[model samples]
Target: MPVDAVEVGDLLLVRPGALVPVDAVLVSEHAVLDESSLTGESLPVERVAGERVSSGAVNGASAVTMRAVALASDSEYQQIVRLVEQAAGSKAKVVRLADRYAVPFTVLSLLIAGVAWAVSGDAVRFAEVLVVATPCPLLIAAPVAFLGGMSRAARHGLIVKGGGTLEQLSRVRSAAFDKTGTITTGRPVLDRIVAAPGFDEKSVLQFAASAEVYSSHVLAKSVVAAAKQQGYALLEAREAEEIATNGVAAQFASDATAAVVTVRVGKPSWLREFAPTLAPAPLEPGELAIYVAVDGRFAGAIVMRDQARGEAGQALHDLRLLGIERTLMVTGDVAATAEPIAARLGIDEVHAECRPSDKVRIVSAVQPRPLIMVGDGLNDAPVLAAADIGFAMGARGATAASESADIVNRYDTLASLPLAVRVGKDTVRIALQSIWLGIIISVALMLVAAFGFLPALVGPGSRRSSTSSRSSVLCAPSDRARSGVRIIADRHGRSCGP
Candidate 1:
């Protein structure tokens, strides 16, 4: 049946890798779900019968039956989409610096021209003042400087949209960040292996990896990779079977004993069916433990976690130095999982277990104006679009988030963010400098012409020369910006800054 046709109380089967179409209650005895898109949890979660699962979570290694509890339009995924549309529609347009000064500059120029004409009664004097007071530098300087800045940002792996975005970026005082894939690596890795009584860690790992190699679960892949990294020689399974959402059971011939050894690897609940004496492994926040059993006896446990990016701490520190006064982390993960990462990275606040709308609300409430939101998931799209400046970690992020962002960081590193800020600040500084230079020179020439010190014949030529000099001043910043970025990159070793 089509997802749109799914009504409340309708029973539906969710196949492995397929998204749940609506909010539903699980009908199967056990199921595994990947809720990363909705919750930012890196690891898949196990759900038993009678548990409710939200829409958009990917079914993992199992075809489970569920009864829909909400209509497709009212589902969690659809609600997030609606929030994104609403947020994007309501986002305020950034006012350009040039535009803000245009009306005032025009009034000032015309006033000076009219005064010259009225006092001197010389049309020639009036023409000369107007010619010198023309806003060429004001008109051209900001765009050129912003283009130069955008070019520099591009070289450093940031794709800034327009001059206004650069202006907003330069003024960013607060920043909100998504947790998984933004601060953390997003991929689960084996943290440690704990062997039960009568079992060695190596033996437990070897047996788990041998059986897990044939399973399609994400955790299984991590276990296999860890075993390979540790130089474990995996024994080929003589017979293997995978029970969806449960565990993998396999038989492997022992090299020394010359007998078939039975092994099982999966959730503690699944392993407990075979090894009734299995003890639960202690876990810290953000950690996941996979249990292993050998020939109906409890063997050991493999602990896994999504590790924080190596450069994340330094990147946050650089942002603080760049004048981002407040930093907050908003994530769909639980507080226990997010607080530690926030504290370690020096983030001032943590909003955990956020839905997409919740993320938008939290980020929208952040103070000190010109807020920037950085994210890399579908759940982050709405909040990204709502922020004053949205930076999408696009290298491996969702397409929706990238599309919604004002600036897309092409590199898979947070180092580009602070570099982008520096570029914006430099670009805006150069633009304002050029504008002021043009205004001062124009006003001086206009006064000189009005007072008969400069001939009308020479006035236009002097204005042209002044405009040329201002253009040169605008272009010089690009070179300086490039050199400055290169210096920062060298000083930080390219991982912490760009």
Candidate 2:
């Protein structure tokens, strides 16, 4: 069967919200492609003229035409599928540096052929040795070990997205985490409420909750929660408008007076423009201060505190023990909040007040050998791509983040991170063991081929005494290597340890 079809000349296909099936070059200006399948880039990437593109990557924004650059089988997605296919069908021979050893094995096989030809002086003898000497062990053992490791990981609920990440996990020396949703639960609790100027604690919460009831932001929910817990009767609000990326503004006019009032619940920066004098100075550690205002007047400040996850400390400890030299928390959260969490979890480094792009840059600056980034939000995608290996909290992470990640925690917990590292180590061990077994078996066969024995194919010399008796070759390495009798006898008949 034909492996791939090549396009005659340059074929143009219009891609619209669909992955291109063949590698191509952009023929239209301003074409946007979603390269999640090929490059694992979560965001849509724009392609102009002369930019090379891969197959199985989606096109976005608007339809655009592209010229075929590679045949269907040679595309990136095709190669991935081919690797997975071969891996599934073959028994894994545990072998590292397979490509590195291929040349040596080929040369050795050629030498064996020449030696057999010289010894027997027959061309058929050389062919027999060549046929049996091919290293099937290398092909069969490596993948078996890899698959066994994968099976264990699947049982543990950690999904390694691909073999590349599995291999890199063994070398991870540093791990970076996105703070808000990784080290701590992303939920915030209203810890304290302060009333300003003319408002009491009860009155401030009532107005805040009234404006927040119509909003869906996490902080707004915290406000409504506080009002319910404190037994305050929230006033009905009308025409509540949520300001994007900030807070909510509600229309509240007194029933007795015809006066109109605008109640705003937001951050200190937003209110500073209107009520600069009423803005409270920033507080110290562990406090998440949110500002509130009514009719251009600062109403109060609400302080929030989020609790760290239960497994965070233990996970950090385990990572350090696994030879992860550094553990860093990178987040947009203020220094006051980030520092305490970093201290409590025993993280070695902390980078606070970082924007999404800044977090990527900060993480990218970390020691480069093998870095694993764990995150679960929209902002985590860039850093996820920047890291050598990225683990996404799949259950709670944004779809984009999950798509870009190399591995995913089906159960969102820091606890599973270390378990993943263990699986990777075990997989590498199994692969190596399989390779050694193959090598030993091949070496033993070569020795057998050197001596004439049995009618034992022309590859091995025929021995009259030992060969005439029934003899067979064993391919299993581990069983044969370990089943031999002990050789402890001494020349003087003295006892020797086995």
Candidate 3:
């Protein structure tokens, strides 16, 4: 059926290799789903009876029966499509700096020509002065300056899309960020190891890591990495099975100290309920635990947490100095997980548990016309396109984020954000300088032309002089980009351009 015709509560049979057309609650025994396309989660998730799954997840190995939770128009994937389309279709206009000066400059040129015609009583003199008054500097030199700025930013590893983006960056009044993969490392690290009775921490960790080697869950990688750090050799496992979102089970090969045993690791709800003897460990705030069981008996738990980036503090501080009025952390993570991180980073506001549509609304609702949003994930794509200016941290390579953003931080550093702003401001300053420089020279030449000192035809001097002004604008950056470029002025960080 067409997506539009699909109604709520409709039971749909999602076969293997099929894309889920709507948000649904799984009705089958189990549903293995690849949600990476919507959530930026790399591992496949398993949804069992009554568990809700979003649209856009690819159904895995087995067929699944699901009851639709929402119509297609209300699904997550379709919502993003709507946001992108609205942003694309909206006829918002951006006035260019060059264009800003065009009208007045033309009026000034006509006034100068009319005055020359009245003074010299020569029709030919009016033509000469008018020809010399061409806005070539505003037209040509400004864009060249912007291109150099783009090239300069590229040399520094920031992929600015166009001069318009640079203009937007220079004028940013506030900034919003997506938490995961934006301000934090986005990967969990093993911070605590809690072992049960009859098991040492190292032993539990080794077993868990050995089992995780056969899994691709984000937490599994953390457990394995922690084991590696401790210099423990993992035992070889014969067969392993992932228990959906709950945990994993693996059978270890018979070794010197023990016979082949089945080891399971996952959530407390799943493990503790099945194994009543399992020791229940109280979880600390911000700490997620992975429970381990041996032969259906409770073993222990591995506690992990994601850490904020070391450079995040400095980056936010720099944005403040650059006059970003507000900084908000917008995330889908719950307040319990998002607030402390925001406080630690000194962010002024926190918008937690935001869906992609929520993020778009947040960005669109900001008071100031020019706001910058920075993010890196599939979930961030819609808001990125909707924001006044969007920057994608393309450290992990091209993604939906990179496609939607106005600028891509190819260098993968938050610190580079302030640098982009600074470069944009300077580029606009130089571009304006170049444009005005040409206009001033031409106005002076017009005076000479009015007195018949120059011919009726436009002189080569007019072109040469305007062309020479370029070197002052472009070539002054002798190795300046190599050493970090300084903010050209303390006051030029006002708006996009004059």
Candidate with the greatest lDDT versus the true structure:
1
lDDT of 3 by residue, 279-380 (tens): 767775556778898887777888887778889999999988887998888887777778898999999899987877788888888866588999887678
Candidate 1 lDDT over 250-369, as tens digits, reads 999988899988999987888888899999888999998989999899999999999889999888999898899999999999999999889888899999989888888888888998
Least accurate stretch of 10 residues (summed lDDT) in model 2?
472-481
Once fitted onto the true fold, the runs of candidate 3 whose alpha carbons sit more than 4 angstroms away are 1-21, 31-46, 57-74, 155-157, 196-200, 215-218, 238-246, 251-262, 273-277, 284-286, 294-299, 367-369, 394-400, 410-413, 461-498
Which candidate model has the greater TM-score, 1 or 2?
A: 1
lDDT of 1 at 439: 84
Model 1 error, position 436 (Å): 2.1
lDDT of 2 at 41: 30
CA shift of 139, model 1, Å: 2.4
Q: Write the per-residue lDDT of candidate 2 for residues 1-498, one digit (tens) a residue.
A: 132655734656664666676788887765656543333232235577778887766676356777887787776556544543332334222234444455687688678768877888865545444435546656667667667777788888788876556677777899998776688876666767888878887777888888888764545777888889889877777579876445678888766686777788876777777676676746656556767788888889887766688899998899888889988888766677788888988888888777555766687678855888898865676567667787888877766577667788889788999999978877776776777777667656764554333123333322222221222121111112223555332334432222
What's the TM for model 3?
A: 0.78
lDDT of predicted model 3: 0.77
Number of clashing residue pairs in every model?
0, 20, 0
> Per-model C-alpha lDDT, please?
0.84, 0.67, 0.77
Better of 1 and 2 by lDDT: 1
How does residue 59 of candidate 2 score in lDDT? 72
